[model samples]
Target: MNSKKLALIQTAMKLFYRKGIHAVGINEVLKVSGIAKKTLYHHFSSKDDLILACLHYREQLFIDWFKQQLDAVPAGKAAILAIFDALDSWFNNRSPAMGEFNGCFFINASAEYGREDSLIYAACQQHKSHVRAIIKPHVDAFEADENKSNQLTDSLCLLKEGAITTAKVQAKLSAARDIKPLAASLINHPLRQANI
Candidate 1:
């Protein structure tokens, strides 16, 4: 995409991430982004298309940042802790790419765009699955059985979601750190038999 098109996506994403998908209007995006309606329509056929573009844009950005954070730590329990650590910075708006998080953008968008068939909702699901993919490697190493690995990933994902939700609601980004202990417990569980 060209600078103007990318700018529109970024602007709209920030607005949608801060507010909500339905709460934000096309005119508001255009006005805030300083893009003309004709140009926006030229780039995206409709508001929904624009929203999808923004989701795609954000999905890439979010995953890249998340992977970077995960990479900073070795693949082990520390790697899992790295996720909550990253969430701390993200919730606190410490990342330049992410302003003060209203919550997980995908989670927020999914709540509003709940219809199973909606592209926006599908994008949300895809983003979450991508997150799981990123996390699976760390969890997989801790569990020899495939089913146990999947279960571990699911548990970790829930802890992450819970941490994000708690952080947002409690008005303290550090609240996400609470997940660390629970995560450690899961990682060090007796049944796992793997060194965390």
Candidate 2:
């Protein structure tokens, strides 16, 4: 995609994610994206196609950002903590248009589409798998034993799911605060201090 088309996707994604995919129409997307209808249609066969493209673009950006954050953390305990650090960065950002930014784009878009057959869904699945892979090592480092590692990894996933839901409902990070203590006690203390 050219810079202009990529810009349209980026702009449309922010609008779609903020408002909703169903609520935001093609004209609004064109208005916000500052792109001509002819150009937009030339790039995307339909609104659905544009939505899929936006999702793919967003997914790539998210994966790149995640990898960068993961690489910055120290292995083992520090890496585990970096998960929360990344969440904090995501939640703490303040914008005039989108305030707290609590909603998960994948979850929201999936809910709006009401089905799982689009490129967007595929991108979301890939993101989830990538996140699981990132968390696996942290789980292993925290527990040492394979069974224990798997158990903790599952537990951490629960925490993540809860955090996302809670943020969505409450529109703030109170639930994330709740998860922190449990995560600290469950995954941090013993694991980081092990081998004593």
Candidate 3:
């Protein structure tokens, strides 16, 4: 992409995240981006097109950040649980200048675009699926049996989603960390009782 286009998208993303999609208009994006109407139109055919681009960009940004955090830990329970640690850091304003945990950009977009079939909503779902995909590997490695692995992966995903939503709603920065014990219980608990 051209520098101008990238700049526009980046600026629009910041405004959309800070202000909101519906709240921030194209005029604001243009003003903040400092790009001419022709240039903005040249890059994106419409505001909806730009919104989709922002969602795609956010998906990549979040997943890449998640991968880095997950990879920092060695594979196992530590790697599996690192997802929440990452979220905790996000919620705690670890990067005050960046992210600052605005309750999942994709989640915010999902609310803005309520139609299930809408591109915006689909992008949000795709972002979540990527997160689940990342967790699946750790789960498979932890659980030797394929069936057990699938079940554990689903549970972990639920825990992660729950933590995210709860943290946002309750304004609890440690919500992710707080859920660690429960997760540990699930992981430490063997799938079956031995000789029971």
What lDDT is reached at residue 146 by model 3?
A: 79
The predicted structure with the larger TM-score, 2 or 3, is 3
TM-score of 3: 0.92
Assess each prediction's global lDDT (C-alpha) against the native: 0.87, 0.73, 0.82
In terms of lDDT, the poorest run of 10 residues in model 2 is: 93-102
State how far residue 112 of model 1 sits from its true place (Å).
Answer: 1.0
Clash-forming residue pairs, model 1 = none
Cα-based TM-score, every candidate:
0.94, 0.83, 0.92
Runs in model 2 lying further than 4 Å from the true structure: 94-100, 142-144, 188-196
Model 2 C-alpha lDDT versus the unseen true structure: 0.73
Query: Which regions of candidate 1 are displaced past 4 Å?
Result: 190-196
Per-residue alpha-carbon lDDT of model 2 for 27-124, expressed as tens digits?
99889878899999889999889888877776777667766766797776676666666665666663233234647777787777755676767766
Better of 1 and 2 by TM-score: 1
